[model samples]
Target: MASKDLAMGMTFLTQTVTGILANVVLLFHYFSLCFTGYRLRPTDLIAEHLTIANTVIMLSKGVSQTVQAFGVKYFSQITRCTVLLYVYRVARGVSVSTTCLLSVFQTVKISPMSSRWKQLKAKLPKHIGLSVFLCWSLNMLVNCIFPFYSINKYSSKNTTKIKYFRYCSSGFPDKITEALYAAFVLFPEVSCSGIMIWSSSSMIFILHRHKQQVQHIRRTNVSHKSSPESRATQSVLVLVCSFVCFYTLSSCFYASVVNFSIPSWWLLNTSALISTCFPAVSPFVLMSCNSTASRLWFKFSGFVRRR
Candidate 1:
């Protein structure tokens, strides 16, 4: 429950406007994936996962952002509060799961034959879908408990303010629930992030070794071919760096949000913005690195212009 008019105005201006633009970008990307039809590249796990993540982000943010945008008007109502919490919580889960899947897939793609993670390469697609469904369902449960545990009644002394959850709003959850929520946050993150860093480092090492070999050949031979592979490797390096930085920042923001003592509205807004903006921003990053995506995006742009 928010008491300040300034807060409402801030949320509307800072969160609402940015969120609307981010969601518009996300929807465009998601629809573009479907329109270009995963038909051309049905076998590419990276392509499929990226498209699915974008779609999920768009759906979750689309509902939550709209609800929040209109929430000030419906602040006093029970249904609106429940809807807001449900959408917000579900969106949070979907965001985390999609990111975890992305990191894991990238890691597996770059890993060696003897890599312990090779088994995942075969089962990952089915596993990712199942994981998404289960995560969404389970996270929705945590959010649903809010309706039963939370209260949206007006403040005793004022007409403007509202209070949520008489008992459940404050601190630590119950033993079982706390454990479950903690597991949800920790398990995938530690595992996914560890593998991502390892695999990324491995790729960078491989690229460097190849570069060294090329340099050796250049030193001995009078004529050396200036190749595009170096450029491709540089692009991949840039792509990896972008993903790592954005995802790390988003995770940090989310961690701060879990602490009940945090009072910064900007932190909350940034966290939400990062979650929604990733899907929209990621395609641009990928397209910048890959000629195929760049061409497809241009083709899609031309089609949209015709309409």
Candidate 2:
């Protein structure tokens, strides 16, 4: 293999393996907590779902990209291409929706406990499972059209209106069909993203206001340690900011690939790299930010040291 191909394969392989392992660890942590009869918070449930989606994203996209980077054709059949791409798209959409849900849930969780807020907060936990189910259902329905248009890469030669996706190809439909597809795909994602941004901004404002209140009450310049809520808010903010940054960049790269008649290998690789960044990094971010996870990690490290 060329040095460039080898490097790309290694990079993707590293990302895929790291992300899968991290996600698996996170999942195990959650399951262990549950099995120990520990009550999981609503956010924990959402985070568990998000971790599952991230694992799917890594397996479907990251692993395939790594294989393709090594000059191996993984999606050799149309069915394989369609199924993998569809699953990846659905998982990605679920990740976005779940993140948005997490942000909104946190916003409600930390809001001032007015009567209205209290009512909504009380109901939110009850609905988390339903909300997640809806996310999966909606995305599955929205992206179902992809299978009909998907074709094997080798079959691209027979068609002029196909968009090449390295190992697979998708037939470009008529303008109207394309426009409708775009609207279907973009609407839910855009809406979820907007909600996430709004919730994040509300969280920032609330945190700032709370800080001001604390400072005024203390009437001193000395810094005080943050509460659990504050730390969690900060972590969620970091998470949302990272997701938005990586998602925007990935979208741009994806658009560029689609716009070109024949996207360069490097462009495709770059897009794939950008797409996997959030999945690869998010589990570590969650682990570091979570107090329980931190404590568990410290204990594990201490045990290993003693051994």
Each candidate structure's TM-score, on Cα atoms with residue i matched to residue i, is 0.59, 0.91
Which stretches of model 1 miss by more than 4 angstroms? 1-43, 66-176, 217-240, 296-307
Which window of ten consecutive residues has the lowest lDDT sum in model 2?
A: 151-160
Model 2 TM-score on a 0 to 1 scale: 0.91
Taking every candidate in turn, the Cα RMSD to the unseen true structure, in Å, is 6.9, 2.8
What is the C-alpha lDDT profile of model 1 across 1-307, one tens digit per residue? 4565356445545544444344344345545666876542222334344445455555555435444544444343454445555565565555555555555455455455576767876666566556656756775665565454334343234222222232113223355665575676556555656665665676677557666757867799886764554454454455556556767788788677765444365666566666555555555654554565566667765776699
Single out the weakest 10-residue window by summed lDDT for candidate 1. 159-168
Report how far residue 81 has shifted in candidate 1, in Å.
Answer: 6.1
List lDDT for all candidates, in order.
0.53, 0.84
Give the per-residue Cα lDDT of candidate 1 at 151: 42
Residues 1-307, model 2: lDDT tens digits: 9999999899999889878877877888999999999988888989898999999999898888888888887465654578878999999999999999999999999998863578998898999989999988988988888787777655655445777666766765476776687777877877887888899999999898888778875666465678888888888888898898999899889889989768998898999899999988888778877867766656665775699
For model 1, name the residue pairs that clash: 151-165
